[model samples]
Target chain A: MLGGQFLETAIWGLPIVIYPFLSGLMAGAFVIDSLAHLFGFKQFEPVAKLAATSSFAMVLIAALAPLVDSLQPAKAPLELYFRDHFPYSPLSVFIIIWTLYVILMFFEMYFDYRVENIEKSKLSGIRGSIARFLTFGNNNISKESLLKDRKALFIISAIGVPLAFAFHGYIGFVFGAIKARALWTSSVMMLMFITSAIVSGAALVTLLYVIGYSYYSKKNVVNIETLNALGIFMIFAIAFDLFLDFIDKLYSFRAYTEADVFHGWTLVYNAGGVLFFNYFVVQILLGLIIPLILLIFKPVRTSKLMMVIISIFVQVGVFAMRFNTVIGGQLLPKISQGTIIPEFPWLGFDGILSSIGLICLSIVIFFILGWLFGWEDSNKNGFENQTNSVDN
Target chain B: MSYRSDFSLKEADEDCNQELLSANFMSWLVKSIALGLGGLFALSILNSSDSADATEKNNSNLPTGPINNHRWMGWENPVLDDKDGWNDWDKLLNPKNLPVWYDNFHEIGKTKPKHHWVMVIDTRKCVGCQACVIACKSENNVPLGVFRTVVQVMETGSMESSPNGMVVTDDGNYEPNVKKFMLPRLCNHCDEPPCVEACPVKATFKRQDGIVLVDYEKCIGCGTCIEACPYNMRFFNPVTKTADKCTLCVHRIDAGLEPACVTSCVGRARIFGDLNDPKSEVSRLISQYPTARLKMSQGTEPQVFYIDLNGNLEGNTSMDKVFMEYTYTIGFNTTAYKKLGGEVDLPKIEEHKNPFKEFEK
Candidate 1:
């Protein structure tokens, strides 16, 4: 046959990559929060409030990722819900599930902080006024009311566990459901997304807890037990994530169809240089394997500085995993036999700037929430000691 | 720290006053902006709905006579009368010569055509002229860097000989000679289109007549449909800010006119008609030839069929030799080519010296 060239451009870019990464963080953080409240894990008690609020903040920002990624952000709601409603679409289902998850997180956080909100409402200034408003005019801080709030919080957190999994799992299904793209169509894609989300989420919250407690609090308090527990969780999640990656690769290799072969070659042979290096070096070796090996040793897991450093690597590696999944899938032409498309430009509306800007904005929002809620003051013993002394 | 009794109520009141003022101002600003944007969107939607209602009402009131008036097309025209019609109206409406699908008029008791549109590409007649591609671009105003229809050329076989010997003289050996074929691809308008299922907003959908169309106004340009399509036929139209693909020229089809690509095929390679009608050209060709659809294993049940699809020309298996040659344009870079780990440069096209004529016995 005569040789003719066909050129196809990458349609989805950085925004798509960032959106899934953000959503994964939201799901992962919320699951960690649930581990304390529902399962009664005493080791996670110190960071329980931090994780809950962080989860709430992450969802708020994560919701905006897809909207900003849209070419028509303003019209998205009208188009999605009214004009072009497809209830069966995974994306539409994701939106519904994500909204419910956010609401559940909000209620859980609100009830957990209700008693504190009543006390803060007595203080002078805008902080007090905001706290008062948040309490919904019911200043009842009675013991019975607090017990009811605890029950509600426990129930919501329990519900939130699976909802968080579903939220991130559906995000995976968004790509996995596309039967045409061999790389994304695996049954393991959803499991892979969930596991990686846990790794990234745990890493992020660990970093935040260490930084927030050390810098923001008056006493510069550091909960060694809590940090160590989070480190252990991150290690296990990363190991599971790596295991899933192995299973996915094994399945693809065994299937060995033309499309599967092409997908495998693309990743292994550096068909797209960025994807190959990103997967092997950054994601696998540095992100998953190194972190796993480091966390297994008691010295590294117990050392606060070492744990922080390892978590940072885990975070970067998990993000790289998301990048490899989202962008790598689009790199190849849908035709199994076709060549890969060019890399998307890093500048402009759909580029890396949008991704970084959104992430920075989310971080800023989280810090602002942390300050407003006085999350830095949330020490388990510190709160109990102060209240007991006051009663005496 | 002392309990709430430490601060005076007057001090708290002063602090509350300042905070309330700022909070009220921020709330007001947000409300006003939201209201302003909401009004504008509502107005636009209302105006569009009003216009659509008017068009429907006008169409229902159209006159039934002068069925052969070309100016009326499928759209109604009350001004047209039998007195102003051409003499060949009876000849044009004759079912024996023309299929029932050809009639666009809505007579009082006339039934709608039981038609399912399809296309048949006779690869044997194609000469890689790319006339259909140009015609489709012109008709659809498809932007550069993306295509609604493309004529891809596939060449196979290697130009190297075995290590231990001279070049083999086998007919199947492509070392000294290569065989090429042209494939004109467009939207398959599949019976079970994945794009429709993948569209979160349902912006892309299949019509009752089997044409896949994108609702530009409703599309948010999330690009999910573009990823869902196995053919890579869909593209993000920057101008429209929506996902776009070949609509099979529904505008012309509705008017009983052939698609621009079908009309402009220089080699008479493309045949378009109602596949449901056994006597239609496309249906007849399907029956006569052992036609094949691209990626049939995908189960998309594509409507477009190809005649005489040669071996090694199936699917995108032959894209290794295919090179996309075009002038560099902004927003039109081929990421797929770069991802394939190839040097991103346009190679010189080799002129064929009528090798078939030279090799003839």
Candidate 2:
């Protein structure tokens, strides 16, 4: 029951929110890909190819979210080519970082699939023709060439670990650098973003691995050991993310000036009813805390059904986290106190449809890559088997 | 019979030749006419620029005053008719006709007089009529639901008595006893503008004279500059598709005219001039009055200063009843203001309430 008051918030809408979330997922998936190749984690080896292909698919679709969200979609290229003169802007740096990461990941995927593509090229029809074109006429499938491909992938994955961190960490810096918004301006924002990205990435790849394994092998080849390891990794990442959230709350209570106290309260307590629930209940309880507790149990970690359910919850929770961070930060008026702007429209170009469209588009890309790479035919003699045999 | 047939055939052939020649002649004539017309059209187009210049010259020569019935009506100069016509006519009729402020402007670039432009607003004189806001909107062509300037109204302290002697709240639930004051707000044109720093393309930059401007072409409509501004002064202009804010009326200021908001202010509350010049009105007022800039703790060094500022200017009011009034739709809400009703309850004041009084002992 407030009196005549107007609330002004950020002009950015759902597309901008989805852009960061999708990019975070992409970065997270790539980090998981690096876990097997670069870190030589045996538990992740079985899913490494799956993770790499998923990450590549994610990267291919990452730019669409922001480009579609831009008011002038045609002029978006100017962000890199024409107007990227300012070195101080996090966004300018982001363009360069995102481009480099995409190239590295793309090349890594290409080399990983090169031998298989040459084999597929020897067959007849359009798929073979496409495979032949993809092979770029490098028909030499000698052990030495295959070894070189592995070495190249190892090198790229090594560089990609930091690149993944930078790609997603810079997105956090974009929001954190805004000194105007009280909720967004914090040094811990980048760490929070990166940690949660890992949590979400682990959850998504685990879910994809289970689905792909069941579909391709026609058996419940859900690797219990891999799922257990991923469950553990997710727990740690979620713990760190929650710890940052705790520290942010504590800092608000202790150090905020009198003028900023209301903003701090809005983030924790007085955020409108829906947003409050979204932040506290959905993000913290369901997304972080519940999953953490569930993953701690050996039975839940080993159980395929249980792990899949927890991963789904963790992803939902991560999405809620992003939603709250982005949309919640913009609810309160910058100058006025005790008033909140209503949520943005859920329909239209900037709303629910566009977000759903982007996700659907990403799925389409994932399936297309799956078909092209013969993901379903896991029995096929390919790099994954070769790499597994070498590791053994 | 054979000779007669040959003669008739020759005659028929001659008739056919005549018809073909006439047809060819007609087509040639049509082509020649079309070619001549196209050439004339091209020639006219090429000479149009010269004609345009001549027309501009003709416009300048036209009488400055309205035409009268007599041919020589506007030809006579009023200054020339005076006694000192010989000495003053040339000066008075000069096309430049510079305003008095131009002398001060010319002096600025010549010696580099440490020019730091500043604005001083006397809150005591503001009546909340919003002339300044309207003037700025028209001057800048600000779109609806966005403002280059705004007037913030903060009401506090109940009045002792109603001026009309009949006190009634709109809802008739309580007495109308609110003491309200309007605070005019615009871009402070801070020395360290966060918006300028946040621009990825350097589209928005602060000029040497302290006015910040946006290069619309380079902006790319990122809206990051709008996000970085603490005061919420910058907004996306749908017309230009770029972030825009108050330029301090730089166009007018360059020609030695006061900002439109300053000129249009009904209360004469706003004063604008170079802060470096001690003789400037803004400088004198700053020295004479106790003034404060908004959000000084942020260290932006805002150029817009306020005098007699009161009632939670820093937005640190502890009163539970005070709520901000925004007269336009913001975010997703289309309602003009959130539920406006009931008399504003004023906080009670304690007599002899100074916390520092005990410390003095």
Candidate 3:
């Protein structure tokens, strides 16, 4: 989809600047999981699961997103993939990692899901025979196999974390590189993208799981302990993201050229008054702060329903944050100096709206697949089918 | 025994068709929609190109001229069609193309300096006539409405009088007496440019002689360098679908001729030379005089510079002024039109001077 968008821009002169955000979201999801899992944030387990699965699904969608907007959709990848000059091309790097990350996530999920069937088959003679057949007739669920899976997950996630950062960070770096425009120019942008990715990922997974549990089990299995812990993490990530943006704008506002000031104001305000206040205040205060307060409050943190509402708000906030960073960053006009004046129609609708719709649709598909694959399976029964001894 | 059999049977059912079914449906739906949307997007792009061509034909009825009057080509023609000397709604979106002869005629270096060509725009001589902007566009086949260079006017002092009998400013704004001057700015083409460093794929790069250029083909339209530049010079060319900025007329400079802006300076205020050569006019001016670059402290190291920038016309001062009030003192001087054949008594310098310097500290 991303390739198509690029192709469209190259061919049709599409005015939309939202293509990078969609791709950033894809890689950003996995990056969030790597942070939670590696740091051993058990409260982030729900977030981790959501990030892993959403990123997994988005990888497939983002790969095609650019193509949807390109003139020669088929030939777009050839620009980077062709062996003539493949090495060091950023697109080539992204394509290679995108493929690797998706495959790694797929195998990780497969290995994880197979364990459940192995345990179920152990209960009966006939059913055990069937479970044995289903799991390639293997019956090992010992400490050795568990240890191997744990190690594999750790290694992959370790490597995947940086790759995920590189993936989303590359997008920020791309925009920041343009010195012709004062609005998009900043060294801190890539780091901002990476940090925000964590924010979005943490919020997304927590919200999805709570909803998933409520939808399927009807008993609110998303524990308050998990929600409270994840909510706290969300606040930290969000605050950091906001701070970086403030520093960038404040520094520019002091000495901005007329064009820079114009662009800067557009970035901060847009046609709709103060761009951040509308999206960010709601995203931060209502989405992050309220939930954070709830989690900190003794009464709300213990309630499953309250926790569920807070998680939903957090996830929504994260999405809005991405929208603001990606879209708001580009809203500023180029070449502002002195008393910066706002200009443009610099942004447009076509690509942004289409991408949002497509991403939502892809997410819906991800949930349906999760439902069928039994995403709710507990670890106790899922590990028995491993042929090798389990450890860890 | 029965429970084990049932569990195995369920596992078998899931593995056989249930798992593949969900995955396949998702893959199919996503892939198909993606393909369809992708195709539509491509078709629309192709259609836009065709539409532009058609609009070009219809643009003959339009007013064809330069748009923002800046040196260098813009992405679109300056014309918007009119009916009976009024606005023509149909021609607003339809753009016209440059003359065929304008394409590829002057490849630069053919008639001008081969490399390291530079220009010094003397603000003292500039009358804000905008001749350089017009001359550059016509000479370089630049498109209308977009400027590769801009002449900004800085006005300082206030129009109001203070309570004292003296002609001091009462209103705080920089409008008194209107001591205005024009600063024509273009690509600095810095030696260590921030734009080049910010580009992820090296789409925009600095030449050996310090001219920064963009390769339209290689650019993915990511707009990274636009954000990197503290100077807002780069513009997104919607037609070419790439980021563009001034290249200091490298092509013209390479042709062994002066840049359009330099040659077009009617008052001879603009000077072009090779700073590396000690004999060069620019080198002579820089070594012998007080010259200043735009935003020197930012460390981009811009090649462009100015001379005789008055005391009130220093660096950016808006932020400092908000925190404190500044005091300005006026002084008088006489510049004789003829060469002074004899020494004349000069007025004593006033010790109680302007207080602008305190803000910098």
Candidate 4:
């Protein structure tokens, strides 16, 4: 088995396979919160709020991702957070950490909301009592309480930073342990997951902010400075990702491990090959590189619209990388001692039912949660007021 | 009595406090000492077991010996040796270090056989007889659609011939000659095996005798090992969920007899032996004739050598077709197949039209 690489096993099926993605998203959210609140980067204040909202959405999705594998989604909790399963895998460890993080994030969000509602609400009796219990009976909007809450937020955000990275980085480690498949056997896969996480997180923030500011207000509060800074960050992240990709590909080529390079070459040059150069150039260069270059330029980067569009490309580019990495590694054949050839389904094999449906459900849940928590609305309301005041 | 009755509430509270304080201290001290001893005892047991278990597993079953010696040790029994000093190879071989080439073995008499057992499969000599196949099936009780040895017939030239029984060529009717040959395929039982490496659970392990075997109960049914065998010899037995391949009749071989397939071959094409023994039949044949192995470039170093191997090194063999069928599940992607030298060209079928679309319009 080509030096016994186990990377392919980590990505064999869908629901179990989505562990890396869920863990990565959570890690990215925590990183953002850490940057804004814990590290005290005032310019990164928007990211703190954004991270919390995304964290909440991602935690909710992760809580349900396991249910996709179970016959009964509701009953999954009994086997997971409640009772012990026979064998403990890396996935089991991830589930435990993810559950703890989700609970903590939920409570933190609840506490924040309760404070806000304590100021807004005039309800009495049980509703009031429940609200008081959540806020610890303090409805005071005093400077001291706000400062204390911020400190607590900072402490949790700091703790969350590494927990987030561990969530996804471990998935790569799992794949690397598989020595059977040559394509998935390298240490570089872990780094690839991490870099991709950064790109996705940055793009997500850029998209959300641009949409919130543009639709809600006649004037955009997000100036050229903020948008340009984000674009520069994204460009560099994408560049680093490409650099890592080059290293990984070159290493595989040099090692001749499991015929990965040979198989990759044939797919590139063969007449009837499914993987065309056009698809490669579009997905890798035009979608990822060109946008990165455009973002690097101050003139283009300064435009909020340009930044948002590039962010979308960055996100798409990262997904293309993931697809190629997962699908490309598996398409080679193993011959005991002869030349091997590989063939793949032209349309690409459809992901398992749970994997696709769970991912879709996660997206829906994210948007719905975003709506409920006023994540988009707060920015929208803030932007509109600023613009109206400027006009007056 | 009058003085005792006159005791104030403060005095009574003090008496109760003194009694309760002594009991609380005693309970706390006793519990603390008991917990400390229990923790220390548990820690020692855990520490000892962890180290001891690890040592026991690692002390054996690791690659630390010459393959033949390891095989010998696996089969040896000190108590049952004869006066002549013939070791207990009979007891040792079966369920021990019997090579993958072993299919079965049995004893005929008490007299020691003059020659150590060996078989040689001349690909040039094989005539695709189904007799050997049937014999092997009955002898080994092999499962349906599964065989210990399969005959792969490859035709090098076109079927059509010129008049007077001459092979036709596009250039001169002489360049491309019609050539057909039969290669009876079985596990090579490689010295360095890819299948063993591919098994995550160590279910498919290599014996010291250079035979690879699958522990069916231990196998996770991942089918990864099946994909790793370049010869495409191993197959997943759906019944057991473990990778199954030819075991060269280890039972028969251990009993000082030939494998079922080798014994049954009508053409006398199969051979089995220990290459290590200088006087063995396999060694004699190797010295006497030029020998080759199927797909030697796979780096497995197969123990089963062929006399005068006729097939092309890069030719499309029957094994390639089987490999293509199970590629997806095993993570043996399309890329690896092309790289290992398989024909990229296949007959392209035109896309079918959607009748529903036409009907709807």
- Ranking of predictions according to DockQ: 1, 2, 3, 4
Residue A312's lDDT within candidate 2 is 93
Write the residue-wise lDDT of candidate 1 on A143-252 in tens digits.
66766776887899888999999999998998998877767888889999999998888987888878777776676477777787888888788878989988776766
Clash count of each predicted structure: 16, 0, 96, 55
CA lDDT of each candidate?
Answer: 0.71, 0.70, 0.54, 0.55
Best by DockQ: 1
TM-score for chain A in each prediction: 0.91, 0.91, 0.73, 0.76
Model 3 spans with C-alpha error above 4 angstroms? A1-49, A59-107, A113-147, A165-196, A216-276, A302-304, A316-352, A358-375, A378-392, B1-114, B162-175, B310-361
Range of the 10 consecutive residues with the lowest summed lDDT in candidate 4 chain B: B76-85
Q: Name the runs in model 1 displaced over 4 angstroms.
A: A1-7, A254-258, A261-264, A267-274, A335-338, A380-392, B1-113, B160-177, B318-361
Q: Select the stronger candidate by TM-score from 3 and 4.
A: 3
Clashing pairs in 2: none
lDDT by residue (tens digit), candidate 1, B1-361:
3555556766678557646755775688799999999999999899778767755644676664324332233122322222322212223222222222111122211434356788999998998888888898777666444568878765555465544434556534334345676778889988778888787886666654667777665678787787788888887764455677888887677668999999999989999999878889998899999998988877788989999986555555544554333223111334444444646555444433332334345
For candidate 2, lDDT tens digit of each residue in B189-223?
A: 88777777777766666655666777554566667
Model 3 CAPRI quality? incorrect
TM-score of 2: 0.77
Residue B190, candidate 3: Cα error in Å is 1.3
TM-scores for the candidates: 0.80, 0.77, 0.62, 0.55
Model 2 alpha-carbon miss at residue B302, Å: 1.3
> Which docking class does model 4 fall in?
incorrect
